[model samples]
Target chain A: MSAFNAQRITAMQWLSRQLLNQDVAGRYFDPLIEPLNPRWALGRMIATVERIEDETHDTRTFVLRPPRRWRGFLAGQHVTLALDINGVRHHRTFSLACAPETWQREGLIRITIKRTPEGLVTPWMHKNLYRGGALEISEAFGNFLLPDVEAPLLYIAGGSGITPILSHLESLACREYTAPITLIYCIRSAQDQIGAQQLEQLQHKLPLLNCQIIRADQGEGQPPRLLQASDIDSIKNIQARHCYLCGPTGLMAVATTLLETRDVPEEQVFQTFFAPLTNPLTDTAGGAVTLMRSNRELTVDSGQSLLEAAESAGLSPRFGCRMGICHQCSCRKTTGTVVNRNTGHVSGPGEETIQLCVSVPQGPVSLDL
Target chain B: MKTLNETQLQRLETGLDAIREDVVSDLGERDARYIRRIIRLQRSLEVAGRILIPLSLTPVGFVAGTASLSLAKIIENMEIGHNVMHGQYDWMNDPALYSQDYEWDTACDSNSWRRTHNYEHHTYTNIIGKDRDYGYGLLRLSNDTPWRWRNLFQFADYVGLSVLFQWGVGLHELEYEKLLSGEISLRDKGGFLKEFFRKGGRQFFKDYVFFPLLTFPVAGKVLLGNLSANLARNLWASTIIFCGHFTEQAATFHEADCENESKGQWYYRQLTGSSNFTGGRWLHLLSGHLSYQIEHHLFPDIPAHRYPEMAPRVQALCKDLGIPYNTGSFGRQYATVVKRILRFSLPERLTRQAA
Candidate 1:
């Protein structure tokens, strides 16, 4: 923490980068160090699981103790957790459910994950990951940040979406900010609600905090009570408050429309999506794809990304993140047009690098796979 | 030899495709853990070897150090480096195991290996004048090519080639035949030569200069240990590779005959042109699973460890299709490889007359 120590650390980092480049150093040292301590890595940020707490039957909270050099995240930011299960590395982004102050003071963070029965990673994490397990985590990212101004805050969360909102509330409580705050927590049933105790503590800490736990599934055969305009209209000065939304697409869409009809300023609205947005090309029939390296040709449907198509065709191409955040799956395309599912940008009919996870061929395409 | 009709070829293709799909889908944590464990074991051996060679006070210490180091280098080159560079573990998405990003502890650069070995040799298997891997342009292995007088003394060249196999592979992509024939000038190979030297220089420095100097008091001993280890690794790797393709039963194809081959025909060519050496797990592991040379040629991108399991299925298919599945004991295979080399040392007419 001292100036001299800081300068020395920077100089050492520079020297190590020059003398022991990551590719070379990592390949040699990682295998050696990993056996002694799985958390130790030369080029990756690895965190050890401190504790595991089950918040609900299907939801669990993992308290992680990251390494010293891990740059902390904003209160509502998310980090990508890389888990090597069954020998293949799988990546998923989860919101940092703990306050930033907690990370700075305790050097620990928490991520609350909801188990999806049909999903690959969540169920594995729930069943296998244990205390003292090491996980690779990327630095905190996402734009669901707190506003600098002293404005009334409105947070709307649906089911597991309460993670980032919990961070925001806890962060605000740590700062002793007493500005008016309203939170609408929606879940299917009472047992499905997460952070109930934390919400109570937060409400007690901030006098103006008003919390509402809404249940969408009333009972069998009863129509589901979704987010209605009355939920927003009940809040005082709802139009003037800065809104943060995190939830399923349907709930977020309804909330956004309600806010828009109320004439809330668009800039004041902040939202984050837990899942990758649906690609526009999902319904179109794909074209022929030629894997030039293997001298194989297959037809891939537009519903699947090139990476998925390749894997299903019994060809394994290099890939990472699988969500277009990492450029690991980028391969050169020799000919044909494609659309980037992330940005919906069409590429020219020329040689160019395209991310296999997000690229869908618009027509007959040839790749250097 | 048996030739298949169109329907039979299609059936063969479908059968092989099913086998590949079964293994590809089953790839997961087990395969990942196996490779990682091998890497760890290799590095541990290397570290122990480096330390023991310099610090030991007896000849046993030196021998142990040299053997350990030699085994480490062999594993790094065969099981780990060769298979990883062939994109066997590419699905893991681990940066260290990535084919494009990996650099092996040998004189040969990974890029050159990927080009010449992965793309060229693999694509053109044992096609004469196409796959440079067949005999590595040093010795005659089959009668497909015209005999040259220089081949008479190629038995000695084989010994020299085995002793310095790493360097031979490092210089393989340069096409020395073209250089000798004035088809390509030294300037045309400037970039390749630079990469070859840079990679080769680092390897030499590590084994001979840097590690030896670390223990200056016994620098000579350490240098000798490193030299012996590298030589042992070179010979082992060369022998394993030769037994894969140059055995007596392994066939060779002409470019004209292989042109426009279908998937089934291509698989058939690979099956006939490569021979497998039966061995225990350790022998197979040390050879980087190249012992299952027939399966490796057919499914080059699959993890080599899986080849043991795949070999039985492939052999069954070969039997069903009535195609030759060449295999034998390691000693028998090596003897046959030597026989093929010696038999081809003379002109085809003279060898046939002698037979």
Candidate 2:
């Protein structure tokens, strides 16, 4: 660690200790630096929802005010929001749908979320969230922003992937940035498009912006072109402009292939997938599994991670991060074929360690629990 | 240590039940706010205290700096570190305040402390053989502990323990007794020893070397000031903690007696096993709110600030139920604790008649 950082840490520790002391400052600020929390660690920042606005039928934008210690975020960075359901903490990552300028001016941050049918966090958020509700948020992170570039921009967004793109656009519009920009927003239906109103307003506000709507649903009038290579051919001067892609798995896959075929330089194409980019596993019907050392046999439900199945079977497996970041939950898969949800790699049947939090059993598997 | 009849025991159980229900319901934002505030004050005091210690050229600067640093250390260990490590503020959902992860600014490793103090001491409070904290495997605090010849030096041992209480706490989990007896091996203690030295080394460097070295011109005086401040904190912590369990009237139990213990019966044991010291708010902060030790034992996870409010209600119930509520002034309790230590140092046969 740098000397400056070490000194700062020591100072912060001392300051937190003073705040934790039995003085008026400690009393009034106790809710923030609770005695049970260590001062030196980067714990979750608590944010209270100031307001909520419906962006679409299934998507809502939540405006939150974080604690005083929260450092400002970049325009297109994503933050992980956490909530507890049935005594378990669940986390979901969403891009900052509001511009950084808005945060600086109003001390407000926003995340626009679209509900997914099988998503536990989003469905719960939609059903339960209200004004003034509190949620835990991580520091804004991710490198999905418009880098310092002189070229024109080609932004392609599908479904709720529009959140971060909208943040960039809003930031650009706020600056009245002169570089020409084009946005091709593809959605299942026109009504399902997120930030539709904001896009309309931005066209008038940012004179250099060119917005295009592509509805790929079967009932749409424009022959329902589902983002094929032909769509790439339709955009004029696609090679010269810097391209950015973010969306559902299908759109991203087709867009990526189309871009690759058109020979757009790899560095010029910046893509960030909000949804999983891992290859789809055809066999998700996980069957009965055996824990060799523990002498326990349990059924693994289709599509359930090994950790979840183990927990359901009255077994506690040590875990941390749960996002495959901290390898605390890695365990020996003595004999089994399991698919890694994060990397999409199928593990061979042998004695090898795998992260239980993100590894799904393909069939009857034996794990050295 | 008077034995109670069945009717009296039942009344005691009923009284404890009422107190628990009342306090459990009273847990709310107010209690949450109280702990949060204490943590803030502790941080501020610590920062200010550490910053002041280097400028100890003048007599007043030295005295004031040492006092501030000592006070900061005292509150950090007692109020913030001890209580928070007990899972007291885990309900807050603030990760920084999580009991499971909080590492205090002491020589003792947090994970080791949880093993020795949280899981062992709290779960088996005052149990003669099971709880290592029952006299910390040194002085025999009660008659239930068999007298040993080595215990005859407890008076001197107490003084050493006081001057270096953090070191003692750091080595609490070493189980050197087991190692010496051939029950465990050096290989077994390797991990623990490594962790101990790592934490203890950092503490030694900060207090003895780093800050003192910074005051190169007046190094001797500043070093002495830091040493004096640490010694003061150590003496204070040992005194308060020792008084909590070793006061004259506190009871110790046989592990057999605790089998299938009911909630009420468990509460009764905690009430009898731990003693409290009475003092003002400042005293409470310095003691880490351990002045209400009985209340703390009963509700280990509850914020310590709530104990004062709980004490009066608990005391009234104890009165109505005819149960003993062991408490007194700090001096009185400390004296009784010394007497217990000295008395227990001798064989039971000699002291039995007086008892």
| TM-score, every prediction | 0.91, 0.67
Those runs of model 2 whose alpha carbons end farther than 4 Å from true positions after fitting are A1-77, A81-92, A98-161, A167-198, A201-369, B1-33, B179-187, B259-265, B312-322
By summed lDDT, the worst window of 10 consecutive residues in model 1 chain A runs over A15-24
lDDT over C-alpha atoms for residue A359 of model 1? 89
lDDT of each residue in A137-168, candidate 1, tens digit only: 88889999998977999999999999999999
Model 1: DockQ score? 0.54
- Candidate 1 is graded, for docking, as medium
- For candidate 1, the TM-score is 0.91
Candidate 2: give the TM-score of chain A: 0.74
Q: Is the docking of candidate 2 incorrect, acceptable, medium or high quality?
A: incorrect
Off by over 4 Å in 1: A1-24, A219-222, A276-280, A283-304, A326-338, A343-354, A361-369, B1-15, B316-322
By DockQ, who's the top model here?
1
Evaluate every candidate with DockQ and list the scores. Answer: 0.54, 0.06
